[model samples]
Target: MDTLPDPVGSSQMDIETSQAGGTPEVANSAAKPRVRAPVRVEEAPKFDLDTYIANYTGRTRYDRLYLIGTCSPSLANEALKAAIAEAKASKDIIKYEKAVRALSEVAPSDPEATLNSAWVQETQRSVNAQTERLEGELKGYKNNLIKESIRMGTEDLGNHYYRTGDLAAASKAYSRVRDFCTTPNHITSMLFKMVSVSIERGDWLSVQSNVHRLRNSQSKPEDAARNEPKIAAAWALAQMQQGAFLEAANSFLAIPADLGDSYNEVLTPNDVAVYGGLCALASMNREELQRNVLDNQSFRNFLELEPHIRRAIAFFCNFKFRPCLDILESYRPDYLLDVHLQRFLPQLYKRIRTKSIEQYMIPYNRVTLDAMAKIFAPSVIGGEAKPTDISSPFVQELIGLIQDGVLDARIDMEKGLLISNQVDLRSEVQRSTLENFREFNQEAHWRILRAQVLYHGLEIKSDKKFGDGGKGARFSREGAGFD
Candidate 1:
C-alpha cells in the first residue's frame, strides 16, 4: 500500500513467497491454538462410592451393608471360603473365633433378613417372659368354666335323687353343691333340695330344721312355696300314722289355700278324690269332705256324670246295696267294679235283702268276689283280706244256692215268679258269664289292665299255670299290701 507497488503483481509475489516458506497465518495457527481454557467436561466428581457408603453408616446401615456385599459377592464368598478352610484346617478355639469374627465383618446382603433375625431374638426373649403370665390367666378361666359345669351337674344329680326317693343320695348331692356354690342363688337352690329330700325321707326333724333355714334365707317366694306343700303333707301323714289325728288334721288344714288350689288343678281325679277323702277322714268332718269333693271339679264332674263312679262312691261311703245296685244296673258298665266297690257290696246286700233277699240276690261273678275279698275281708273276717278271698260267708251263701240247686226255687218262692222272669237272676243265665269274671280277676289281666288304669295299683297276678293254660284264674297275696 505504501507505493501501491504494482498492485496485483506485488500481492501475487507475497502469496508465492508465503507459500515457499511457512506462511505467517500457518505459523500463527500452530502457536498452541491460543489455549482457550481447556474446555472442562466436569465428569460428575468420579462417583465416590466410599463417601456414599460412609454417609449411610447410621441412616441406611443395613442398606449399605447389603450393597457392599452384593457388589463384591465373589470377594466376600472367597473370604468366607478361606475362613471356612482355615477353620477346617485347624480346630483351635482361637482360630475358630478369628474365622467367625472375620466372616461376621462381611455384612449380610439381605437387610430384611438381618432385621428379622434381630427381631426374632428379641421377641423370643419377651415371649418366654410373658408365657407364664398368660398360662396363669388361661388356667383361671378354665377353672371357672369347670366349676360352673360341676355346679350344674351336681344340681341335676340332686334333682334326680329326689325324684327317685333316694333321700340320702339327694342330700349328699345337695351338700356337694352347697359346699362348692359361690353364689347366693346356688346356695338357696341347694338348700331347697335338701329340704325336699328330708321331707321325702320322712325325716321330720331334719325337714323342720331345713324349713327354718329356708325361711331365714333370702329366696324367691314361688320357690319357697313350691317346697313347702310336700313337707307339710308329709308331716301331716306322719302325724296321722302316729294317731295324732287332730294335730294332723290341723296341719293339713293349715295348707295354703293357693297350694290346695294348685293341687286341685294339677292332680288327677283319683288322686284328688283320694287325698280329699284322706283329709276328710283325718278331720272326721263330712262337710270338709263334701267341700273338698265339690272344690275338686274332676271328682264332682265324675260323680255327676259317671254312674259307675257314683255307684262306687255310694257303696264305699254309705255301704248301701240298693242304691249302688240301682246305679250299677242303670249304668250297665262293661267292666266289673273295683275292690273298693266289691268290699261294701256284701254288707250292703245283707242289709237291704234281709227279706225276700233270695229273689233280689244276684249271682257274684269271680271279679266281684275277688274285689270283695280285696276290700273288706280284713275288716270283717279275722284273717288278712286278700283279692282271692272268695270263700267269705256272704259269698258262700250265694255260691251254696247255685250248688244246692235251690237258686231257682228260692227266687220263685221269694218273688212268686219264675226264675226266668227275675231281673237279678237274668244276668247269670249262662255259666260262661263267669268267664269274664275269671279273666278280669286273672293276674295277668289285672297286672296289665289295672296297671294301665291305676298305674301303680293291684300287685296281684294270676298263677302262671292258669294264665299259660288260658284258664284266666286269678289270685293275690294275703294282707294289705301297703304295710
Candidate 2:
C-alpha cells in the first residue's frame, strides 16, 4: 500500500527484496578474494680483492676514499684523518662510511691513523707491546729451522756469487758450506765447486782430486752421468799437465758419448766448441776425428749452442782465414785457440807453409811483429802482447832506433852496449828468447833465428857488404856481420 506511488519502479525493487535474504542464492553469489604469488630475488656475486683493486678508479667520493685506504697504511691514515675532519664539518653519510671502512682496514697496521693527538702515545705503546709479545712467541720456532737451513742457504749464496762472476768469494763460501753439508747433493756440489775453483786457479792435481770425488759420490744417476765428461776432461788436463799426452788422450776417450751430449746441452756454445776442440786434440788422428765429429748431428748440435763459439769453431774447422784473422785481431785468448795452438800449430804450419823451417819462421816473424807493434801502440793489442810490451820494450825500442838511426851515435852506442850487457847479464836473450820462440812456433830453434834476424837488422844494412877477405868471409857466409 505504501509503495503504490511507483508500481513501475517498485517491480524491480520487489524482485531485489525477494532475492536478498534467500539462503541458496546468497551463499552461491559470495565473491572470492584474489591472492598474489611469491616473489623471487637473486643473491649478489662474490667479491674479489685483486679485481676490485685493479679496476678502482676514483669516480665517486667513496671510491676515492677506498683507493686511498687500500694502497698503504700511512696513506690510508692521512686520508681518514682528513675525511673525519671533513665529515665533522658536513656530517655526510657517504664520507662517514668511507672513513669508517678506511680506519677499520688500516687501524691494525697503523695506530697513528686511528688515534688522534689525544690518544696517540697510548695506542703506540699498546701496539709495541702486542708486537713484542708476538715476536717472543715466534722466536722459538724460528731458531729451530736456522741450523738445518744454514748449509743450504750458504750453498745457494755461493752459487749466486759464482753466477755473478765472483769466483773467489764463491770458492770461499762454497768451502764453508761444504764443511757443514754431508748430504749427497751437498757433497757433489762441494766437489764440483772445488773442481771449478782449481781449474780457474790452474791447480791440475786439485782438479783431478775433486773430479775423482765427484765421480765416487752418491749423486743421482742422472747427475753422476752428467758429471762424467767434466771429470774425464779434468783428468785429461791433469795428465797433460804431467806431460802424459797418451794417458790424457786415453782419459778423454773414456768419456761416455751421452756425457758429451749432456755437456753440450748444459754448456754455452763457446764452451762446447772449446771442449770439442780439446776432445779433438786428444784423438790420435785429429783431422779424421774432427771430420767425423763435424758430420755428426749431435756434435753439430753442440756447435749450435752458442753463436760466438759456433762461429769460432766453423772458422777453425774450415780454415777460414778472415775469421781467424778477425779472432786474432780481436785478441781474446779463447780456450779453443789455446788448445788448437797447443795441439796443431806444427801440423797447421806444415800444411800452410809446406816446410818445417818455414813453419818455424812464421811464428818468429809473428812474435817480432807482435812485440814491435805492442811497444809502438800498447793499447792496440792485449794478453801476451801486453806482457811482451812490459818484458821487451827496451829491446823493441833499441831495434827501432838502430834500424831508423833516430838516436845520436853516442845514444846508439850506449843502447848497443846496454843490449850486449843484457844479453850477458841475464843470459835471458838466448834462453828466454829461445824458450818463447819454441813455445810460439813449437820448434826448438825458432827464437835463435828471430834473434839472428834482429841483430842483422840492427847492426848492418841488408845490402851492405863487410869483410877482410877469408876471416870476415866466414862470418858473412854464416849470415853474421858488423858494419
TM per prediction:
0.28, 0.31
Candidate 1 residue 95 C-alpha distance from true site, Å: 85
Candidate 1 lDDT over residue span 363-412, tens digit each? 42112343333333324545545323344465555556556664543222
Give the clashing pairs for model 1.
443-461, 443-462
Cα lDDT of model 1 overall? Answer: 0.40
Best by TM-score: 2
lDDT of 2 by residue, 127-219 (tens): 345435544543543466564466666666555444322345557667777666767877886877777655543456877778777878888
Instruction: Return the top candidate by lDDT.
Output: 2
lDDT of model 2, residue 431: 91
Candidate RMSDs in order: 48.9, 35.2
Q: What lDDT score belongs to each candidate, Candidate 1 first? A: 0.40, 0.44
Error of 1 at 20 (Å): 99
Tell me the deviation in Å of residue 272 in model 1: 4.1
